[model samples]
Target: DTTVKQNPRYKLARVGKPVNLICSQTMNHDTMYWYQKKPNQAPKLLLFYYDKILNREADTFEKFQSSRPNNSFCSLYIGSAGLEYSAMYLCASSRDGPETLYFGSGTRLTVL
Candidate 1:
């Protein structure tokens, strides 16, 4: 199975503090993606990696930061946490793109 694993299923972050979420997969996929989801809203693509290359969405490019330290691991970093940032973050991996996305359960971040 091509499964993506995310750590810290739930996270509690203080306002203005930094928050970090992790994602990993053993399938050796060439691409990984990060998305943010909220109730009644569509999942928004935050960033993604094509092998060692990183790509961020035009609108959200500055709002989110990511790093793929290695082929099997990727991280989503939020420089400063805010109430508005509280949402379900999804990590996915695929051999290509959306067509084969294998998503993790997600990490729910709550800002206090």
Candidate 2:
């Protein structure tokens, strides 16, 4: 199985503090994606990487930051945690498109 793994299945963050979540895969997929999900709402695509190129959703692009320091690793960074930031963060990887995405279990962040 080409699995995507996320570190820290659960997180607690103080309001206004920064939070960082990590994802990694050994498959060496060309593309990696990060999504934010909330109860009763669809998952929102935050950002993605096609090789070394980063692409972010224009509407939420400024809300999150990410980096793929190397092919096997990627990280999602939130500069300031807020009450609304409490949600599930999902990391996925695919060779090209969403059709073949392999998703990590997710990290649930709770902002206090």
Report RMSD (Å) for each prediction in the order shown: 1.2, 1.2
| Weakest lDDT window of 10 consecutive positions for candidate 2 | 93-102
Candidate 1 regions exceeding 4 Å error are none
- In the range 1-112, model 2's lDDT, one tens digit per residue, is 6889999999999999999999999997999999999999999999999999999999988889999999989999999988999999999998865467899999999999
TM-score of each: 0.95, 0.95
Supply candidate 1's per-residue lDDT for 74: 97
Q: Backbone collision count in every prediction?
A: 0, 0
Model 1 gets an lDDT of 0.94
| Residue clash pairs of candidate 1 | none
How does candidate 1 fare on TM-score?
0.95
